[model samples]
Target: MTWNSKLRCFFLLWVLNSNIILASLESEVSAQSDVKDHGEHDNEDYSLERAGSFDQIFKIQQTYLTVQVDQLNSTNTPRAKDEKRRLLKELSRAHGKWGDQHPRKKLLDALFSYSRYFERNIPDVNRWRQLYNHVSSKHKRLLDRTVSYTKKFDRAESLLRQNHFLCEDVVNEALSYYEIGREELRKHIADAEKAGIVADKMSVSQSLKHIGRDWTDDGVSERDGAFPCILDSIQSLFPNRQSSRYKVLLPGSGLGRLGYDVAALGGFEVTNNEVSAYMNIMYRFIETQSKKDAFQVYPFVDGWSHHVTQDDMFYQLSFPSMTMNNSNVILVEGDFTTVFKDSKDKFDVVITHFFIDTARNLMSYFETISSLLAPGGYWINFGPLLYGTGPWVQLALDEILTVTEDMGFQFVDGPESCGSLTFPDKKVRNKEAAYGYSPRALTKNAYHAQSWIARR
Candidate 1:
């Protein structure tokens, strides 16, 4: 409110305006100079856009739309933003400029389908897609082949870049397409009123395998290699086939298939535990289904890399190859370290299948595992050292055993040769094994995960 302060403020604004004016004049002079200095070709018409030929314009349009749709995928989180919606709307209103061969419409449709299904959620979309995969071999091939031709249209980097959307305006258009899948996912959740699925809840990059790799017949091969160990341990401890004699706990039981198989084989009270809501929803969904191998999964729809053909991405797998109605298998849902932490001297056998490395603190897991087992209980583990997220203490095989021994447990049996992951001085004659993988996939993840059977 003082004269001096008002004068100073006016002076600053005047100086700023003066500088902007100067910059504008300088830019104008530079443009004029460049035009004057051009060679003799400058005498001819130099209008850039107007001078282009029909073919040039066509190419421009193709590239522009391609880049526009490509840019629409700059993010993968959500579609509530105004700019993203505007861009998609602008493209949609373009009046079908591209010819029949052009991929504008196809790309647009694909993106739309992705948006609607995305509302249902990624795991839901894939689970819904299982319907397409399970219909028949002939139809499955068609869905597989279609991806080969449509891969380049436009997609984000996740899930093979399958889902991206521009606006909520058009999201409803594809609802009918997505609703069938929505209902399927809902029904799956509705089917199983109780029970849960195992999940680490990592990003899609890590969790995608839960649905894609955990249930397939190929995935079963990994479990098949580990199952015998549990059976052998059980038989060694209690030779009789009593219904409730021995108590076995399986943590990180994705899809509950491993536990299902163990319980199906009979003789022990088996408990399967998991933490992922997505997996839990699907598992419960499978619980109510009647047909064996009726559920299908096309998990690689977005996993375009390390695949030879589109069909490779369409690698369909029918799940629960043989569903057993086992009443003895118990579904316990919660984190492994906390759910049964208060209990002591309970479990007869604790099984870990590709699960031990999921711990952040190896000592805590050992402590928990040790606390749960009876004095003569067996702690059987088979998995690679693929440690989960951080603040984790990663120990070598020797270091892990040392820690296990420190937890008031005695080491027994061999780190023994089984899968390709076991690295003993002498080569073992076991078959090459993978946790979860498609054998024909270009990138091979086959490894001999080390195996061990310890006694408490």
Candidate 2:
């Protein structure tokens, strides 16, 4: 009787324990499912119809904003006053249309509000209490613009939080990213003041456009295909990756990611050349001086799409601490052509990406590379021949090749097409249209983005 009662009690306890375990597993799975659903909702791609209909509208609004800003800053004549009134009206209309309902509209409203703040806050002569307290009109204007623009970025971050399309964490990261930039700029300004030079003309705003991209690894999907190709070419030339230490030049190295990778992995002495001041500053900061454990930024941070939720909108970006502190990675800031123009055959490999188009003269680039590389040096190039210069100066791919050949460089490998370049949440395709936009011009006109390895 005791054995039978004990066995029955044990079975009852075992069944109860199994039920509890099943309930916990179900709850865990349900939680994961909820997360997956939120991810999908946030990351949904913009529909074709929505993109086609609204992308043009977004572009128009952006263009209008740019034009209005220009007019506001122009000569202060009667016409200029009228232009200001018109600009304010346009901003009012935009605010009225969507208010905070749309993230992009909210951003525009923030921008317009800041512009008005700038206009109204211009210090008057009477405001100066003492001679030492007096500020130059130029310095006042610059301060007003900087503070106002910084506020706009702050406001944009706030508005973006209201929209479910993007991640608030990412938005905050971007805001912090810009704030860091602003602080870095203050140091530069202080240095300029100490030297008795005007730093207001540095155009900090213009340098911002591409700095975030370089600070993150988000653009790898579009532009990183050539990284492997270039490495392979260089390794083949040397064969012994561990023993051989080759001299490498990365011209127009935006953020110097590829160059950094080459030096770290290929055991090469790499020099990364970037011409833009802000880009170089940010890149160098991340490469050497970034105080943060890891830096994060949204690539193509400005562009927003109607097709996807804010969550799926920005590419989640972070650059790992692969700085290769032990490796010989140099960051040089200057015009690539001019910097290496007088260079002898000092470099074993020269790598260029989305850079050749920045050249005013394509022939100049060829000549510079030829001079910079050794007799058997390899020049690895990726990116289209979009002709950054005027149409008159723009040369076709064939013309570029002919000039390189004339410069005593022969093909080591390929002009092989990697793939068409496309940015995250952007309508523009390829490096050309991304940089320059025209509704009349086709976006995907150039294709078969070939990577070439030319040996001198």
Candidate 3:
């Protein structure tokens, strides 16, 4: 027991205790960081209050949950570690309030029920919707959840059916939705099974083979009507234009709704040019069936902003079929770039909605649109530059204006900002919802769009 030995022993003991304390502190810091990263801080309440209303709060909460889970899953390795660190830094700043757990699970339940209805004839959609809507409005989260999950499950199902590799979580979620509602949606399920109607087996046109499921519910025309300033300007300018003599061309007229609107004015021979056979078929079906009161189509359901309900699940598209002045309406099935290139007749006007950006060479649109229009006739356009991955470059506002002017057209008005609306119903405006797919962030919804009325 010399002094040197005692000193060495003391040093060893101190080092051991210090290392243990450091390790424990690091572990505790990591745990706190995880909770904070999720904004589920132990100390703070992130309850539904921050969102103003219960529904709003529920959406915010659900979005956070969905996004957080997605981020964790989608990012692994260095990025994942970085994200975890970012979460920790964010959490260290504040506490969260916990409201009664948002009804995220209820959404899954409702989606399972609604999706089961798809197993039967189309009318069964309304039947299932009626029962599902009977739930209290307070639980609207259920419907919203249904929209979110339906798409996820749809994608999952599509991949599985195609024999594509599926993720474990996606497969589990799909199975849960498929099987969970056997008891809850029992009657609908039974009715579906007895009816022996399968949505997958139903015969559809070749054009609709894989992706036309949602075209019939295409509400773009309804939304296009929201551009009153643009539409009004065109109508006023062309009021004196002869009805029988003046021809209107709508290139990229998806399902012909917007073009129908123009033809229904009864002043122009409107020709709807569409490349997709699915849309052409739908346009004809809507026009031919206009003799009926209303045409119903089953569209895949999803949304972010509106209260989710089974009522929101499908579209009962209304056509002013009985009253519509559609004698001048015609359908031309072909690509716009080459469709009318050889035609001897020219048009009095060419108007487009959401079509310009679809062009492989956007500048070329000016040549086509101008060629279609008569001298001093108008070319009015509306739509966002929603560029998903594409083969061609997108044109900015200046580029669009320059191209039109260079093509020997006089700019009557825009390339001017007229606030855009995607849905005609004001209730749904600016309400945020996320579809499962993520387009390029920079290109998606860069909707600082303008309406241009140029005269050729």
Specify the highest-lDDT model's number. 1
Which runs of model 2 end up more than 4 angstroms from their true locations? 1-155, 159-217, 289-293, 299-301, 314-316, 321-326, 341-345, 389-392, 415-447
lDDT tens digits, residues 1-456, model 2?
A: 110101111111123422311121111111111222233333333221122222121111110111111112212345334433443453343534654443333322222221122122212212322442476777757866865422433433332222212122222222232222323323433444476643221232223324333333443433344555566656666777677688888888866767766765656888788765445444533543222224343332233333133333333445543332413566655577765554443898888876887787767777788788877888887677666537336776666667677777786544223333333332112222133111122232233444667888
User: RMSD of candidate 3 to the true fold?
Assistant: 26.5
> Model-by-model lDDT, in order?
0.49, 0.45, 0.43
Q: After superposition, how far is residue 259 of candidate 1 from its true place, in Å?
A: 0.7
Tell me the deviation in Å of residue 252 in model 2. Answer: 0.4
Q: Which 10 successive residues of model 2 have the least lDDT summed?
A: 1-10
Task: Please report, as a residue range, the 10-residue window in candidate 1 with the lowest summed lDDT.
Answer: 1-10
* Index of the highest-TM-score prediction: 1
Clashes of 1: 7
Q: After superposition, how far is residue 217 of candidate 1 from its true place, in Å?
A: 3.1
If both were scored by TM-score, which would come out higher, candidate 1 or candidate 3? 1
Model 3: how far residue 198 lies from native, Å: 16
* lDDT score for candidate 1 against the true structure: 0.49
